[model samples]
Target: MTSTFTVLPVPLDHLFSPGDDINSIVIEALSTTRWPDESTGISDGDIIVVTSKVVAKAEGRVVEAASRESVIDQQAERIVAVKHTPRGVTKIVQTSHGLVLAAAGVDASNTEQGTVVLLPVDSDASARQLRDHVIDRTGVAVGVIITDTMGRPWRLGVTDVAIGSSGVHVLDDYTGRHDDFGNTLEMTVVAIADEIASAVDLATGKL
Candidate 1:
Protein backbone atom coordinates (compact mmCIF):
# COMPACT_ATOMS: atom_id res chain seq x y z
CA MET A 1 0.00 0.00 0.00
CA THR A 2 1.10 3.56 -0.70
CA SER A 3 1.69 6.01 2.10
CA THR A 4 -0.53 8.57 0.37
CA PHE A 5 -3.03 8.74 -2.48
CA THR A 6 -5.14 11.27 -4.33
CA VAL A 7 -8.85 11.27 -5.05
CA LEU A 8 -9.88 12.85 -8.32
CA PRO A 9 -13.46 13.14 -9.52
CA VAL A 10 -13.98 12.68 -13.23
CA PRO A 11 -16.13 15.63 -14.31
CA LEU A 12 -18.93 14.59 -16.62
CA ASP A 13 -21.34 16.94 -18.34
CA HIS A 14 -23.68 14.56 -20.12
CA LEU A 15 -26.46 12.79 -18.31
CA PHE A 16 -26.12 9.02 -18.53
CA SER A 17 -28.75 7.20 -20.53
CA PRO A 18 -29.51 3.57 -21.23
CA GLY A 19 -27.19 1.81 -23.69
CA ASP A 20 -24.43 4.42 -23.19
CA ASP A 21 -20.89 3.10 -23.05
CA ILE A 22 -19.72 3.98 -19.55
CA ASN A 23 -16.11 3.03 -20.22
CA SER A 24 -15.87 5.42 -23.18
CA ILE A 25 -17.62 8.13 -21.21
CA VAL A 26 -15.29 7.85 -18.22
CA ILE A 27 -12.15 7.61 -20.31
CA GLU A 28 -13.16 10.68 -22.27
CA ALA A 29 -13.81 12.61 -19.08
CA LEU A 30 -10.48 11.64 -17.60
CA SER A 31 -8.67 12.43 -20.81
CA THR A 32 -10.13 15.91 -21.22
CA THR A 33 -10.67 17.22 -17.67
CA ARG A 34 -7.86 19.14 -16.02
CA TRP A 35 -7.01 18.00 -12.50
CA PRO A 36 -6.68 20.29 -9.50
CA ASP A 37 -2.91 20.24 -9.94
CA GLU A 38 -3.32 20.99 -13.69
CA SER A 39 -2.46 17.41 -14.59
CA THR A 40 -4.43 15.72 -17.35
CA GLY A 41 -4.82 11.91 -17.72
CA ILE A 42 -4.92 8.76 -15.66
CA SER A 43 -1.96 7.43 -13.76
CA ASP A 44 -0.83 3.82 -13.34
CA GLY A 45 -2.06 3.39 -9.79
CA ASP A 46 -5.20 5.52 -9.90
CA ILE A 47 -8.31 3.72 -8.72
CA ILE A 48 -11.45 4.69 -10.62
CA VAL A 49 -14.39 4.69 -8.25
CA VAL A 50 -17.74 4.84 -9.98
CA THR A 51 -21.17 5.14 -8.48
CA SER A 52 -23.31 2.10 -9.23
CA LYS A 53 -26.22 4.30 -10.24
CA VAL A 54 -24.45 5.32 -13.40
CA VAL A 55 -23.42 1.74 -14.08
CA ALA A 56 -27.02 0.64 -13.72
CA LYS A 57 -28.19 3.38 -16.01
CA ALA A 58 -25.68 2.44 -18.67
CA GLU A 59 -26.72 -1.21 -18.40
CA GLY A 60 -30.38 -0.35 -18.98
CA ARG A 61 -31.40 -1.23 -15.43
CA VAL A 62 -33.92 1.59 -15.14
CA VAL A 63 -37.51 0.43 -14.93
CA GLU A 64 -40.84 2.19 -14.95
CA ALA A 65 -42.62 1.38 -11.73
CA ALA A 66 -45.88 2.60 -10.35
CA SER A 67 -44.38 2.09 -6.91
CA ARG A 68 -40.86 1.41 -5.87
CA GLU A 69 -42.17 -1.21 -3.50
CA SER A 70 -43.33 -3.29 -6.41
CA VAL A 71 -39.95 -3.19 -8.02
CA ILE A 72 -38.27 -3.96 -4.72
CA ASP A 73 -40.46 -6.99 -4.31
CA GLN A 74 -39.42 -8.21 -7.70
CA GLN A 75 -35.71 -7.67 -7.09
CA ALA A 76 -35.52 -9.02 -3.57
CA GLU A 77 -34.36 -12.57 -3.10
CA ARG A 78 -35.45 -12.65 0.52
CA ILE A 79 -36.85 -10.21 3.02
CA VAL A 80 -34.41 -9.82 5.86
CA ALA A 81 -36.33 -7.39 7.99
CA VAL A 82 -39.10 -4.79 7.91
CA LYS A 83 -39.79 -1.75 9.97
CA HIS A 84 -42.72 0.60 10.22
CA THR A 85 -41.61 4.19 10.68
CA PRO A 86 -43.62 7.36 10.82
CA ARG A 87 -42.83 7.97 7.16
CA GLY A 88 -43.64 4.55 5.74
CA VAL A 89 -42.68 0.92 5.71
CA THR A 90 -39.01 0.16 5.10
CA LYS A 91 -37.87 -3.22 3.95
CA ILE A 92 -34.37 -4.59 4.27
CA VAL A 93 -33.91 -7.33 1.78
CA GLN A 94 -31.24 -9.47 0.21
CA THR A 95 -31.07 -8.78 -3.48
CA SER A 96 -30.74 -11.35 -6.20
CA HIS A 97 -27.15 -10.21 -6.56
CA GLY A 98 -26.52 -11.49 -2.99
CA LEU A 99 -26.35 -8.00 -1.53
CA VAL A 100 -28.27 -7.36 1.64
CA LEU A 101 -29.46 -3.78 1.37
CA ALA A 102 -32.50 -1.63 1.80
CA ALA A 103 -35.16 -1.80 -0.88
CA ALA A 104 -33.19 -4.51 -2.67
CA GLY A 105 -30.83 -1.82 -4.03
CA VAL A 106 -33.65 -0.09 -5.84
CA ASP A 107 -33.05 3.63 -6.16
CA ALA A 108 -35.65 6.26 -6.97
CA SER A 109 -33.60 9.40 -6.63
CA ASN A 110 -32.28 11.60 -9.47
CA THR A 111 -34.10 9.74 -12.21
CA GLU A 112 -37.01 10.37 -14.52
CA GLN A 113 -40.36 10.53 -12.85
CA GLY A 114 -42.10 7.18 -12.41
CA THR A 115 -38.85 5.32 -12.91
CA VAL A 116 -36.29 3.79 -10.58
CA VAL A 117 -32.79 2.46 -11.14
CA LEU A 118 -31.72 -1.04 -10.19
CA LEU A 119 -28.29 -2.21 -9.18
CA PRO A 120 -26.01 -3.59 -11.86
CA VAL A 121 -26.60 -7.23 -12.75
CA ASP A 122 -23.04 -8.09 -11.76
CA SER A 123 -21.04 -5.28 -10.23
CA ASP A 124 -17.75 -7.19 -10.08
CA ALA A 125 -18.02 -7.91 -13.78
CA SER A 126 -18.80 -4.26 -14.42
CA ALA A 127 -15.74 -3.19 -12.49
CA ARG A 128 -13.54 -5.64 -14.37
CA GLN A 129 -14.82 -4.39 -17.71
CA LEU A 130 -14.17 -0.76 -16.77
CA ARG A 131 -10.69 -1.59 -15.55
CA ASP A 132 -9.94 -3.40 -18.79
CA HIS A 133 -11.14 -0.41 -20.78
CA VAL A 134 -8.91 1.98 -18.84
CA ILE A 135 -5.86 -0.20 -19.40
CA ASP A 136 -6.63 -0.67 -23.04
CA ARG A 137 -7.08 3.04 -23.70
CA THR A 138 -4.22 4.50 -21.66
CA GLY A 139 -1.89 1.53 -21.11
CA VAL A 140 -2.15 2.32 -17.41
CA ALA A 141 -3.17 -0.33 -14.91
CA VAL A 142 -5.70 0.92 -12.36
CA GLY A 143 -8.21 -0.50 -9.91
CA VAL A 144 -11.94 -0.05 -10.28
CA ILE A 145 -14.57 -0.02 -7.58
CA ILE A 146 -18.31 0.26 -8.08
CA THR A 147 -20.20 1.68 -5.12
CA ASP A 148 -23.71 2.08 -3.81
CA THR A 149 -25.19 3.94 -0.87
CA MET A 150 -26.47 1.92 2.07
CA GLY A 151 -27.53 2.44 5.63
CA ARG A 152 -25.75 0.40 8.22
CA PRO A 153 -27.67 -1.97 10.41
CA TRP A 154 -26.94 -0.11 13.66
CA ARG A 155 -25.66 3.17 12.34
CA LEU A 156 -27.32 6.43 11.41
CA GLY A 157 -27.17 7.97 7.93
CA VAL A 158 -26.12 6.33 4.69
CA THR A 159 -22.68 5.95 3.15
CA ASP A 160 -21.17 4.54 -0.01
CA VAL A 161 -19.99 0.92 0.08
CA ALA A 162 -18.22 -1.08 -2.60
CA ILE A 163 -20.40 -3.54 -4.44
CA GLY A 164 -17.87 -4.59 -7.05
CA SER A 165 -14.12 -4.35 -7.50
CA SER A 166 -11.43 -5.29 -10.00
CA GLY A 167 -7.65 -4.97 -10.22
CA VAL A 168 -7.73 -4.26 -6.48
CA HIS A 169 -7.35 -6.34 -3.38
CA VAL A 170 -10.67 -5.87 -1.65
CA LEU A 171 -9.40 -6.98 1.73
CA ASP A 172 -6.20 -6.54 3.68
CA ASP A 173 -5.94 -9.53 5.97
CA TYR A 174 -3.69 -9.38 9.02
CA THR A 175 -5.15 -12.24 10.98
CA GLY A 176 -1.85 -13.84 11.87
CA ARG A 177 0.34 -10.75 11.78
CA HIS A 178 2.08 -9.26 14.74
CA ASP A 179 1.48 -5.73 15.99
CA ASP A 180 4.10 -3.09 16.72
CA PHE A 181 4.05 -4.27 20.35
CA GLY A 182 4.98 -7.81 19.19
CA ASN A 183 1.52 -9.03 20.15
CA THR A 184 -0.01 -11.50 17.74
CA LEU A 185 -2.95 -10.01 15.93
CA GLU A 186 -6.19 -11.77 15.04
CA MET A 187 -9.18 -10.73 12.98
CA THR A 188 -7.57 -7.51 11.78
CA VAL A 189 -8.77 -7.68 8.24
CA VAL A 190 -9.69 -4.40 6.61
CA ALA A 191 -12.19 -3.80 3.87
CA ILE A 192 -10.00 -1.65 1.67
CA ALA A 193 -12.46 -1.47 -1.19
CA ASP A 194 -15.28 -0.18 1.01
CA GLU A 195 -12.99 2.39 2.57
CA ILE A 196 -11.98 3.64 -0.86
CA ALA A 197 -15.64 3.80 -1.84
CA SER A 198 -16.48 6.01 1.13
CA ALA A 199 -13.50 8.25 0.48
CA VAL A 200 -14.42 8.66 -3.16
CA ASP A 201 -17.96 9.47 -2.13
CA LEU A 202 -16.62 12.36 -0.09
CA ALA A 203 -14.75 13.66 -3.12
CA THR A 204 -17.50 13.10 -5.69
CA GLY A 205 -20.56 13.79 -3.52
CA LYS A 206 -23.95 12.28 -4.36
CA LEU A 207 -24.59 11.14 -7.90
Candidate 2:
Protein backbone atom coordinates (compact mmCIF):
# COMPACT_ATOMS: atom_id res chain seq x y z
CA MET A 1 0.00 0.00 0.00
CA THR A 2 1.07 3.56 -0.63
CA SER A 3 0.00 6.95 0.63
CA THR A 4 0.33 10.20 -1.24
CA PHE A 5 -0.29 13.90 -0.58
CA THR A 6 -1.17 16.38 -3.29
CA VAL A 7 -2.09 20.05 -3.60
CA LEU A 8 -3.74 21.31 -6.79
CA PRO A 9 -3.93 25.02 -7.33
CA VAL A 10 -7.31 26.11 -8.68
CA PRO A 11 -6.99 28.50 -11.57
CA LEU A 12 -9.61 31.22 -11.39
CA ASP A 13 -10.42 32.67 -14.81
CA HIS A 14 -12.26 35.72 -13.63
CA LEU A 15 -11.49 38.50 -11.21
CA PHE A 16 -13.54 38.48 -8.06
CA SER A 17 -15.32 41.58 -6.85
CA PRO A 18 -17.26 42.70 -3.85
CA GLY A 19 -20.66 41.01 -3.55
CA ASP A 20 -19.41 38.12 -5.66
CA ASP A 21 -20.65 34.71 -4.56
CA ILE A 22 -17.52 32.84 -3.51
CA ASN A 23 -19.38 29.59 -3.00
CA SER A 24 -20.54 29.53 -6.60
CA ILE A 25 -17.28 30.85 -7.96
CA VAL A 26 -15.34 28.16 -6.14
CA ILE A 27 -17.69 25.45 -7.36
CA GLU A 28 -17.42 26.72 -10.92
CA ALA A 29 -13.66 26.87 -10.83
CA LEU A 30 -13.52 23.34 -9.49
CA SER A 31 -15.91 22.06 -12.08
CA THR A 32 -13.48 23.00 -14.83
CA THR A 33 -10.83 20.82 -13.23
CA ARG A 34 -12.85 17.66 -13.01
CA TRP A 35 -11.46 14.50 -14.59
CA PRO A 36 -13.39 12.42 -17.08
CA ASP A 37 -14.22 10.02 -14.30
CA GLU A 38 -16.52 11.89 -11.93
CA SER A 39 -15.34 9.71 -9.08
CA THR A 40 -11.98 11.47 -9.34
CA GLY A 41 -13.45 14.87 -8.69
CA ILE A 42 -13.46 16.47 -5.24
CA SER A 43 -13.82 13.63 -2.76
CA ASP A 44 -14.67 13.19 0.87
CA GLY A 45 -11.90 14.19 3.28
CA ASP A 46 -10.16 16.35 0.64
CA ILE A 47 -9.27 19.80 1.90
CA ILE A 48 -9.76 23.02 -0.08
CA VAL A 49 -7.45 25.78 1.01
CA VAL A 50 -8.24 29.26 -0.29
CA THR A 51 -6.25 32.43 0.02
CA SER A 52 -7.78 35.10 2.26
CA LYS A 53 -7.63 37.73 -0.48
CA VAL A 54 -10.55 36.22 -2.41
CA VAL A 55 -12.46 35.64 0.80
CA ALA A 56 -12.00 39.26 1.80
CA LYS A 57 -13.04 40.48 -1.62
CA ALA A 58 -16.17 38.34 -1.57
CA GLU A 59 -17.00 39.68 1.90
CA GLY A 60 -16.69 43.31 0.73
CA ARG A 61 -13.64 44.11 2.79
CA VAL A 62 -12.05 46.42 0.25
CA VAL A 63 -11.20 50.04 0.96
CA GLU A 64 -9.59 52.87 -0.96
CA ALA A 65 -5.85 52.62 -1.36
CA ALA A 66 -5.38 56.01 0.24
CA SER A 67 -7.08 54.66 3.32
CA ARG A 68 -4.64 51.77 3.69
CA GLU A 69 -2.76 53.28 6.57
CA SER A 70 -5.88 54.40 8.39
CA VAL A 71 -7.58 51.07 7.80
CA ILE A 72 -4.55 49.20 9.14
CA ASP A 73 -4.58 51.38 12.23
CA GLN A 74 -8.25 50.66 12.79
CA GLN A 75 -7.87 46.91 12.30
CA ALA A 76 -5.03 46.73 14.78
CA GLU A 77 -5.82 46.14 18.45
CA ARG A 78 -2.42 47.46 19.47
CA ILE A 79 0.80 48.29 17.70
CA VAL A 80 3.46 45.74 18.51
CA ALA A 81 6.30 47.21 16.48
CA VAL A 82 7.02 49.56 13.60
CA LYS A 83 9.74 49.97 11.00
CA HIS A 84 10.45 52.77 8.58
CA THR A 85 11.91 51.66 5.28
CA PRO A 86 12.56 53.27 1.90
CA ARG A 87 9.14 52.20 0.66
CA GLY A 88 7.27 53.38 3.70
CA VAL A 89 6.40 52.49 7.26
CA THR A 90 5.69 48.90 8.26
CA LYS A 91 3.78 48.01 11.36
CA ILE A 92 3.34 44.79 13.27
CA VAL A 93 0.20 44.83 15.30
CA GLN A 94 -2.29 42.58 16.99
CA THR A 95 -5.52 42.42 15.00
CA SER A 96 -9.10 41.71 16.03
CA HIS A 97 -8.44 38.17 14.85
CA GLY A 98 -5.90 37.87 17.70
CA LEU A 99 -3.17 37.58 15.07
CA VAL A 100 -0.08 39.70 15.58
CA LEU A 101 1.08 40.43 12.04
CA ALA A 102 2.36 43.12 9.76
CA ALA A 103 -0.06 45.94 9.04
CA ALA A 104 -2.68 43.92 10.88
CA GLY A 105 -3.12 41.81 7.71
CA VAL A 106 -4.47 44.75 5.70
CA ASP A 107 -3.06 44.05 2.25
CA ALA A 108 -2.73 46.30 -0.78
CA SER A 109 -1.52 43.86 -3.38
CA ASN A 110 -3.24 42.03 -6.26
CA THR A 111 -6.24 44.28 -5.93
CA GLU A 112 -7.77 46.98 -8.06
CA GLN A 113 -5.91 50.26 -8.37
CA GLY A 114 -6.61 52.61 -5.48
CA THR A 115 -7.90 49.80 -3.30
CA VAL A 116 -6.73 47.56 -0.50
CA VAL A 117 -8.05 44.30 0.87
CA LEU A 118 -8.85 43.81 4.54
CA LEU A 119 -8.91 40.55 6.39
CA PRO A 120 -12.20 38.78 6.86
CA VAL A 121 -13.97 39.72 10.08
CA ASP A 122 -14.18 36.12 11.26
CA SER A 123 -11.97 33.64 9.44
CA ASP A 124 -13.26 30.55 11.20
CA ALA A 125 -16.81 31.48 10.34
CA SER A 126 -15.79 32.17 6.78
CA ALA A 127 -14.20 28.75 6.50
CA ARG A 128 -17.26 27.10 7.98
CA GLN A 129 -19.54 28.84 5.53
CA LEU A 130 -17.35 27.91 2.59
CA ARG A 131 -17.16 24.31 3.72
CA ASP A 132 -20.90 24.03 4.13
CA HIS A 133 -21.57 25.64 0.79
CA VAL A 134 -19.12 23.42 -1.00
CA ILE A 135 -20.65 20.34 0.57
CA ASP A 136 -24.12 21.48 -0.39
CA ARG A 137 -23.13 22.12 -3.99
CA THR A 138 -20.94 19.11 -4.67
CA GLY A 139 -21.99 16.61 -2.03
CA VAL A 140 -18.34 16.16 -1.12
CA ALA A 141 -17.39 16.32 2.54
CA VAL A 142 -14.34 18.48 2.11
CA GLY A 143 -12.53 20.65 4.60
CA VAL A 144 -11.94 24.37 4.03
CA ILE A 145 -9.06 26.50 5.17
CA ILE A 146 -8.61 30.23 4.73
CA THR A 147 -5.03 31.47 4.79
CA ASP A 148 -3.22 34.77 5.16
CA THR A 149 0.42 35.69 4.73
CA MET A 150 2.38 36.67 7.80
CA GLY A 151 5.99 37.37 8.66
CA ARG A 152 7.23 35.31 11.55
CA PRO A 153 9.18 36.89 14.37
CA TRP A 154 12.42 35.14 13.40
CA ARG A 155 11.77 34.72 9.72
CA LEU A 156 12.95 37.08 7.01
CA GLY A 157 10.18 36.42 4.51
CA VAL A 158 6.44 35.88 4.80
CA THR A 159 4.56 32.59 4.66
CA ASP A 160 0.91 31.63 4.50
CA VAL A 161 -0.83 30.51 7.69
CA ALA A 162 -4.32 29.34 8.43
CA ILE A 163 -6.59 32.03 9.82
CA GLY A 164 -9.77 29.98 9.42
CA SER A 165 -10.62 26.32 9.09
CA SER A 166 -13.67 24.02 9.00
CA GLY A 167 -14.38 20.29 8.58
CA VAL A 168 -10.75 19.62 9.35
CA HIS A 169 -8.97 18.86 12.59
CA VAL A 170 -6.62 21.75 13.18
CA LEU A 171 -4.50 19.94 15.71
CA ASP A 172 -2.94 16.50 15.81
CA ASP A 173 -2.35 15.50 19.42
CA TYR A 174 0.39 13.00 20.11
CA THR A 175 0.08 12.92 23.87
CA GLY A 176 0.44 9.47 25.45
CA ARG A 177 1.95 8.11 22.23
CA HIS A 178 5.39 6.57 22.51
CA ASP A 179 8.23 7.42 20.15
CA ASP A 180 10.75 4.96 18.72
CA PHE A 181 12.68 5.35 21.94
CA GLY A 182 9.57 4.37 23.93
CA ASN A 183 9.44 7.85 25.43
CA THR A 184 5.85 8.85 26.12
CA LEU A 185 4.75 12.04 24.37
CA GLU A 186 3.05 14.18 26.97
CA MET A 187 2.77 17.54 25.22
CA THR A 188 3.25 16.92 21.54
CA VAL A 189 0.88 18.52 19.10
CA VAL A 190 0.94 19.66 15.47
CA ALA A 191 -0.96 22.54 13.92
CA ILE A 192 -2.47 20.66 11.02
CA ALA A 193 -4.27 23.59 9.41
CA ASP A 194 -1.25 25.84 9.38
CA GLU A 195 0.87 23.05 7.99
CA ILE A 196 -1.62 22.53 5.19
CA ALA A 197 -1.69 26.24 4.44
CA SER A 198 2.09 26.40 4.29
CA ALA A 199 2.25 23.43 1.96
CA VAL A 200 -0.38 24.96 -0.29
CA ASP A 201 1.44 28.25 -0.23
CA LEU A 202 4.62 26.61 -1.41
CA ALA A 203 2.73 24.90 -4.17
CA THR A 204 0.75 27.94 -5.28
CA GLY A 205 3.43 30.59 -4.72
CA LYS A 206 2.54 34.05 -3.41
CA LEU A 207 -1.02 35.29 -3.52
Candidate 3:
Protein backbone atom coordinates (compact mmCIF):
# COMPACT_ATOMS: atom_id res chain seq x y z
CA MET A 1 0.00 0.00 0.00
CA THR A 2 1.21 3.54 -0.78
CA SER A 3 1.65 5.38 2.49
CA THR A 4 3.08 8.75 3.40
CA PHE A 5 4.26 8.90 7.00
CA THR A 6 4.36 12.23 8.77
CA VAL A 7 6.15 12.33 12.07
CA LEU A 8 3.38 13.36 14.43
CA PRO A 9 4.88 14.23 17.74
CA VAL A 10 2.98 13.34 20.87
CA PRO A 11 2.84 16.01 23.50
CA LEU A 12 3.05 15.40 27.19
CA ASP A 13 -0.24 14.40 28.70
CA HIS A 14 -1.28 13.30 32.16
CA LEU A 15 -1.26 9.61 31.38
CA PHE A 16 -1.75 6.74 33.81
CA SER A 17 -3.84 8.77 36.18
CA PRO A 18 -6.15 6.90 38.47
CA GLY A 19 -9.22 5.49 36.70
CA ASP A 20 -7.68 6.34 33.33
CA ASP A 21 -8.38 4.06 30.38
CA ILE A 22 -6.05 4.02 27.37
CA ASN A 23 -8.54 2.85 24.78
CA SER A 24 -10.96 5.49 25.93
CA ILE A 25 -8.18 8.05 26.11
CA VAL A 26 -6.93 7.24 22.57
CA ILE A 27 -10.44 7.23 21.12
CA GLU A 28 -11.06 10.49 22.88
CA ALA A 29 -7.82 11.85 21.48
CA LEU A 30 -8.84 10.86 17.97
CA SER A 31 -12.31 12.24 18.30
CA THR A 32 -11.30 15.46 19.99
CA THR A 33 -7.69 16.21 19.08
CA ARG A 34 -7.62 18.31 15.91
CA TRP A 35 -3.94 17.55 15.46
CA PRO A 36 -4.37 13.83 14.80
CA ASP A 37 -7.36 14.25 12.52
CA GLU A 38 -7.38 12.23 9.26
CA SER A 39 -7.05 15.36 7.18
CA THR A 40 -4.13 16.72 9.18
CA GLY A 41 -1.87 14.15 7.42
CA ILE A 42 -2.20 10.51 8.66
CA SER A 43 -4.79 8.41 6.93
CA ASP A 44 -5.69 4.86 5.77
CA GLY A 45 -2.89 2.33 5.05
CA ASP A 46 -1.01 4.32 7.64
CA ILE A 47 -0.16 3.04 11.10
CA ILE A 48 -1.13 4.52 14.41
CA VAL A 49 1.50 3.57 16.96
CA VAL A 50 1.24 4.64 20.55
CA THR A 51 4.18 3.56 22.64
CA SER A 52 3.17 0.26 24.22
CA LYS A 53 3.75 1.73 27.65
CA VAL A 54 0.60 3.75 27.16
CA VAL A 55 -1.30 0.61 26.33
CA ALA A 56 0.09 -1.10 29.42
CA LYS A 57 -0.99 1.81 31.52
CA ALA A 58 -4.42 1.80 29.93
CA GLU A 59 -4.77 -1.92 30.66
CA GLY A 60 -3.73 -1.44 34.31
CA ARG A 61 -0.45 -3.34 33.83
CA VAL A 62 1.24 -0.96 36.21
CA VAL A 63 2.59 -2.67 39.30
CA GLU A 64 5.13 -2.15 42.05
CA ALA A 65 8.51 -3.57 41.08
CA ALA A 66 9.01 -5.27 44.40
CA SER A 67 5.75 -7.09 44.01
CA ARG A 68 6.32 -7.70 40.31
CA GLU A 69 9.69 -9.37 40.90
CA SER A 70 8.17 -11.62 43.48
CA VAL A 71 5.45 -12.48 41.01
CA ILE A 72 8.09 -13.27 38.38
CA ASP A 73 9.98 -15.52 40.75
CA GLN A 74 6.84 -17.49 41.35
CA GLN A 75 6.18 -17.75 37.63
CA ALA A 76 9.80 -18.62 36.83
CA GLU A 77 9.92 -22.30 37.38
CA ARG A 78 13.25 -24.14 37.00
CA ILE A 79 12.54 -25.10 33.43
CA VAL A 80 16.07 -26.24 32.72
CA ALA A 81 16.54 -27.80 36.15
CA VAL A 82 19.15 -25.19 36.91
CA LYS A 83 19.09 -22.12 39.07
CA HIS A 84 21.75 -19.56 39.84
CA THR A 85 22.18 -16.13 41.34
CA PRO A 86 19.81 -13.33 40.55
CA ARG A 87 19.31 -12.98 36.74
CA GLY A 88 21.28 -16.10 35.97
CA VAL A 89 20.78 -19.51 34.40
CA THR A 90 18.56 -18.42 31.60
CA LYS A 91 15.63 -20.56 30.59
CA ILE A 92 13.11 -19.59 27.97
CA VAL A 93 9.63 -19.45 29.38
CA GLN A 94 6.40 -19.01 27.50
CA THR A 95 5.49 -15.35 27.56
CA SER A 96 2.31 -13.68 26.35
CA HIS A 97 3.27 -14.51 22.75
CA GLY A 98 3.54 -18.23 23.45
CA LEU A 99 7.17 -17.63 22.42
CA VAL A 100 9.72 -18.14 25.13
CA LEU A 101 12.11 -15.47 26.24
CA ALA A 102 14.79 -15.56 28.92
CA ALA A 103 12.97 -13.41 31.44
CA ALA A 104 9.47 -13.18 30.01
CA GLY A 105 10.55 -9.75 28.67
CA VAL A 106 9.75 -8.03 31.97
CA ASP A 107 10.91 -4.44 32.09
CA ALA A 108 12.06 -2.08 34.84
CA SER A 109 12.43 1.40 33.46
CA ASN A 110 10.45 4.49 32.33
CA THR A 111 7.70 4.50 34.92
CA GLU A 112 6.68 5.96 38.27
CA GLN A 113 8.71 5.18 41.35
CA GLY A 114 8.76 1.63 42.69
CA THR A 115 6.69 0.58 39.71
CA VAL A 116 7.44 -1.33 36.50
CA VAL A 117 5.22 -1.59 33.46
CA LEU A 118 4.39 -5.01 32.11
CA LEU A 119 3.41 -5.94 28.59
CA PRO A 120 -0.25 -5.98 27.80
CA VAL A 121 -1.64 -9.22 29.25
CA ASP A 122 -3.01 -9.97 25.80
CA SER A 123 -1.34 -7.76 23.22
CA ASP A 124 -2.87 -9.40 20.15
CA ALA A 125 -6.30 -8.81 21.58
CA SER A 126 -5.35 -5.24 22.36
CA ALA A 127 -4.22 -4.58 18.78
CA ARG A 128 -7.29 -6.18 17.30
CA GLN A 129 -9.58 -4.16 19.53
CA LEU A 130 -7.86 -0.89 18.70
CA ARG A 131 -7.88 -1.60 14.97
CA ASP A 132 -11.53 -2.65 14.96
CA HIS A 133 -12.48 0.42 16.95
CA VAL A 134 -10.76 2.76 14.50
CA ILE A 135 -12.33 1.09 11.49
CA ASP A 136 -15.73 1.31 13.07
CA ARG A 137 -15.36 5.00 13.76
CA THR A 138 -13.46 6.20 10.67
CA GLY A 139 -14.24 3.61 8.03
CA VAL A 140 -10.58 3.64 7.16
CA ALA A 141 -8.32 0.61 6.74
CA VAL A 142 -5.72 1.80 9.15
CA GLY A 143 -3.31 -0.54 10.85
CA VAL A 144 -2.43 -0.66 14.54
CA ILE A 145 0.85 -1.76 16.02
CA ILE A 146 1.48 -2.15 19.71
CA THR A 147 5.22 -1.72 20.14
CA ASP A 148 7.47 -2.39 23.12
CA THR A 149 11.12 -2.02 23.91
CA MET A 150 12.93 -5.33 24.00
CA GLY A 151 16.50 -6.54 24.29
CA ARG A 152 18.02 -9.26 22.18
CA PRO A 153 20.22 -11.84 23.87
CA TRP A 154 23.45 -10.78 22.20
CA ARG A 155 22.61 -7.28 21.15
CA LEU A 156 23.15 -4.02 22.98
CA GLY A 157 20.75 -1.12 22.84
CA VAL A 158 17.00 -1.74 23.00
CA THR A 159 14.81 -1.73 19.90
CA ASP A 160 11.10 -1.31 19.55
CA VAL A 161 9.27 -4.17 17.81
CA ALA A 162 5.67 -5.01 17.25
CA ILE A 163 4.32 -6.98 20.13
CA GLY A 164 1.02 -7.08 18.28
CA SER A 165 -0.38 -5.94 14.92
CA SER A 166 -3.63 -5.70 12.98
CA GLY A 167 -5.09 -4.48 9.66
CA VAL A 168 -1.65 -4.61 8.00
CA HIS A 169 0.79 -7.04 6.56
CA VAL A 170 3.21 -7.63 9.39
CA LEU A 171 5.70 -9.08 6.94
CA ASP A 172 6.44 -8.37 3.29
CA ASP A 173 7.90 -11.58 1.96
CA TYR A 174 10.39 -11.07 -0.84
CA THR A 175 11.32 -14.68 -1.47
CA GLY A 176 9.56 -14.86 -4.81
CA ARG A 177 10.51 -11.34 -5.81
CA HIS A 178 14.14 -11.59 -6.81
CA ASP A 179 16.33 -8.48 -6.81
CA ASP A 180 16.99 -6.64 -10.08
CA PHE A 181 20.56 -7.86 -9.77
CA GLY A 182 19.18 -11.41 -9.80
CA ASN A 183 19.89 -12.54 -6.27
CA THR A 184 17.40 -15.16 -5.10
CA LEU A 185 16.35 -14.50 -1.54
CA GLU A 186 16.25 -17.52 0.71
CA MET A 187 15.02 -18.18 4.22
CA THR A 188 14.01 -14.72 5.31
CA VAL A 189 11.29 -13.18 7.42
CA VAL A 190 11.33 -9.44 7.12
CA ALA A 191 10.29 -7.62 10.28
CA ILE A 192 8.28 -4.78 8.79
CA ALA A 193 7.11 -3.61 12.19
CA ASP A 194 10.64 -3.13 13.51
CA GLU A 195 11.49 -1.15 10.38
CA ILE A 196 8.68 1.27 11.16
CA ALA A 197 9.75 1.32 14.77
CA SER A 198 13.28 2.40 13.84
CA ALA A 199 11.99 5.08 11.44
CA VAL A 200 9.74 6.58 14.07
CA ASP A 201 12.61 6.43 16.47
CA LEU A 202 14.68 8.72 14.23
CA ALA A 203 11.91 11.32 13.91
CA THR A 204 10.80 11.05 17.50
CA GLY A 205 13.34 11.40 20.30
CA LYS A 206 11.99 8.26 21.89
CA LEU A 207 14.79 6.09 20.45
Stretches > 4 Å off in candidate 3: 1-4, 17-19, 28-41, 74-94, 99-102
What order do you get sorting by TM-score, best first? 1, 2, 3
In candidate 1, stretches whose alpha carbon ends up further than 4 angstroms from where it belongs are 33-38
**Candidate 3 lDDT, 22-97, residue by residue in tens:** 6555655655433534555336676777676777777777778877656555445444233466855544455636
Instruction: Work out the TM-score per prediction.
Output: 0.94, 0.92, 0.77
| Candidate closer to the true structure by lDDT (higher is better), 1 or 2 | 1
Instruction: Summarize candidate 2's per-residue lDDT along 87-174 as a digit string, tens digits.
Output: 9999999998899988988888889988999999999999999999999888999999999998888768887889999998999999
How many residue pairs clash in model 2? 0
Best by TM-score: 1
What C-alpha lDDT, on a 0 to 100 scale, does residue 3 get in candidate 1? 88
Predict model 2's lDDT versus the native. 0.89
Tell me the tens digit of each residue's lDDT in model 1 across 1-207: 358767877777778899998988998888875677888787878889999999999999999867678889988989999999999889999987889999898888977888999999999999999999899988999899999999997889988999999999999998999878999888899999999999989898875
Best by lDDT: 1
Winner on lDDT (1 vs 3): 1
lDDT of each: 0.89, 0.89, 0.66
Off by over 4 Å in 2: 34-39
